[model samples]
Target: MSRSFIIDGSIIYTNYSQIIGQSKFEELLREFVDILKEKQSPLLNALNAFKVNSDYDVHRFTEYLHLLTMRNIKEIGNIIYYVNPKDLERFIEAFYTFWRSKHRFMVRNEKYAEDYNRRASIEYTVTMIGDQFKATIKNLYRELMMNVSNTFPTVMRQLPSGAQVMFLIQEPNGEKYRKNEWVTKIPTVWGAIFDPPAIFYTKSNKRRGILPVVEKDILSEIALDPNEWYRFAIYVGDLLMYNFVHVEYLAHGAGLANLFELATPKDLESREPDGILIFGLPADKIPGYNEKWRNGVIFKEEDGYTGVIPAFDENDYFGYMKKTTLTIHNLIKIDRGKLPIHGSMARITLKSGKSVVAMFVGDSGAGKSETLDALNRLEEVAQIDTIIDDMGSLDIIDGHVVAFGTETGAFVRLDDLPPGFAYSTMDRSIFMNPDQINARVIVPFNNYNEVITPTHIDFFLYANNYTEVHNDEERIVFFKNPNEALKVFSEGKRMSKGTTSETGLTNSYFANPFGAIQRKEEHHRIAEHFIKKMFETGVKIGEIRTMLGVQGYEKEGTMLAARALLKVIEQI
Candidate 1:
């Protein structure tokens, strides 16, 4: 016996060997088909597979399986359909295509690429930032021009000494004219001119408007009349000086703003000028008597038994300081090669020799002021002319040192000074003006005080934080300690052959701190290379060379400093 059954419209059965007959099988097949047709009452071609009971049903099942496999293949193809990229393809093509929907892969044209980038918003933003800075300068200038026009009257009343009064028109040179012909011979004044106090009248011709003064010839005609000449100079000088004050203020404010706008505090602090002029209180006036007190300091008492102890209470007071408290003026060394202008703290080379120039620096405080005051006092006591005092101008002429102060003044000893001198005298050294009647009186104190430190040359060394760098590139040396740097530069003896050329032996520095010169020969070679580079770059030019020897033009001094600074590697 054989049993046959159909499941899921497919044939399944076991063949029997004994009872098999064609007529019987045919009959059974007809019966199964009738049952399947009854199960599906409605006639449907798609349903015909269900009514079938033959080998043909197997062929139908095979077709269905093939269709199901095709569906799965389509699903997989949809999941990971991607175009293959060529090995020669550039990243830019992929980048542009990723960013821009309209982009297509092709060889990019240089001109088109440039044009596209130029039109980008990022480029526009950069261009706008630059324009903004320029505009700020213009606005500042306009404001200054208006202010000067309105405040001319006030400025005339308070003109500073050393102020120059200029005129718009200069008098023409001509043959000598009689003093009495003043009205007729006087040049017509136009633009702006300073008014002379004196009429420049001859002793022989004493009439008003009768004698007129010509430029530079004002004193020649009246050699014996210096008093009158000086009076006339001041009157005219005042008028001319006022004219440019507003313009200069505007330019300075704009430049300074631009410099500080983007600078961090560290950047500003790190900016080392050619020299620094310290004007505030002396270092000894601070709570602590130590090198650490140079910047500024605070005092705090440790936990103790209730109130204060006698001598021990003094020891409890200490100082804490920040580097910013120090008042510093950056020196713009001006000499023959440099020009002078407003905002310039000139670093003038003394008449002293080059070796001395390397040592003389400007710093005044308890540690330095007292020691220098002693030397200066000795000269005064000995009735020896102390050639220079506060506010001296230095110039080197024909390899000779020349220094003369703005005016004669007294010198004070630091030891006799009251405690807390640093906090007491903030603007004595840098901003004092002789015309202001603000004379610094250095009265001789015969009395001695135990609180003051005794005189010692070593104080000048430790009180000053000196940093030296050798400019192998420019063959120049720089000293940074303000109080003693200039003095050392001015007085330091030439190093002997056996002395090592370290910071202690020679006060020279490479503006670039990271310069590599471990060996003596390497140092020499680097120096030569730097000198050659500087020469090629016009560092030897009159303006650029001012910083080379500590004395040069006043106007171009900062440029000199910046040039030398390009070689510095570290701060001392």
Candidate 2:
């Protein structure tokens, strides 16, 4: 073929322009016809082997594909539509599944990385002179539109100021989507493609600064096509965070935006954000920022809010976006004399009309969420209202420690839950990497009002997922002293169950590496003040050994912990 593209799994990428003229575009299609004649592709090989249609052989396959556009494919990138393949939908789906399982797409070009994924697929004009071919193409497109619509790869929101923050969701799937209440049962791949397997983070954020240089490299590109992007707003706990996302990472931004409350048009008009993120710049192309930014870094913006730019656009992970937003929110909370916790909080109401707000603090793989999930499953429980699933802040309201949630949704691990947990909520979940390690499911657990509103804390416990609970009494234990409680929480200890790159015993400062690690001394003072206040105010503090990290106790330990919690609640 005169025109070439690097076939990366399901993607056909090329740095050079494919559109030369009508004649050239037709020639390219002719080349594809030749390639199809050999029945080289697995889908074609199987089709021929089965002899699905004896009337037409591989050489006569050109009739199936109508020449799309006679222009260069560079404007929006290359795409292939299956059209109305009828029963072949499964076979075609299998074709894509086979390629996706093989390897991730590689963009091969050493320079000029395309600042986009999820290449836009549009309706082809079918400029060929032949009426038969044109009619076939038109009918296929009509049939295609009836089933799906054009959706972007990145989830984007362009601000009125033209600034944007876009979240490039990693390996999006059609199993579920995030809508109002994470609407369920819609498995439409309207705007997503099968991305390569996601890898564990080799690098994590480790640096912070007072003020960072405002970047323009990405801004310049967005200026070239200002109308292309979409827009969004967020309230991270109590702080307003505005984002202007460039169009390059469109379609998938909703997954990221759903983590927080979507600001109303009224909210956008009345308030200024405490933090702002301008996304879409390629990390490799930008200059003067710290080299460690490639690793991950957060800095104060000139406008007084925390600023975060994705470290790398190429082969990036959603963690960079998720954590950066959390870091900024946590930092603001820290500055405001509030305590940000890397934990989970739930208000559990027993069948006897007794309710208690239980707060579990620990790092990843610590069973903070698993124990709460277990409590929800108990028959004696009325309902467990989850105030926070991962990150939240502690504040003194009316002389009592009150917990506020950070995220509107829950990004949960599939392997940790009971067998049917994820599948049962398939209607309102975004399933990611379900076939791989650290497979996760993101679901909207509650609404914005519930997240931002404060809930009083009754039982403050450090999750001890690594420890073995030999008996019911051992499942939950009080620290006996405020200092002892402080000492335990300060250590931030947990046993790694492979949620991250760590193994064995691990300790993070106050179980939060996002913000406190950057301002340890200040956070230490805050933690001490809060710990003593909780003790003084009659809030019971202790540890619950869910043993989620125990080699064989993953499921059983959480149940034991839940039952013990129930017993404790009943006695009170």
Q: Residue 450, candidate 2: how far off, in angstroms? A: 1.8
Q: Please, what are the lDDT tens digits per residue for candidate 2 over residues 194-274?
A: 211222221221222222323233322222133333344567788876554444433234445546676543343355567
TM-score of each: 0.18, 0.67
| Stretches of model 1 off by over 4 angstroms after superposition | 1-335, 338-360, 366-369, 376-381, 410-572
Off by over 4 Å in 2: 1-64, 67-230, 244-252, 309-315
Q: What is the C-alpha lDDT of each candidate?
A: 0.22, 0.58
Candidate 1 — worst ten consecutive residues by lDDT sum? 233-242
Question: Which predicted model would earn the best TM-score?
Answer: 2
* RMSD for each of the candidates: 39.9, 13.5
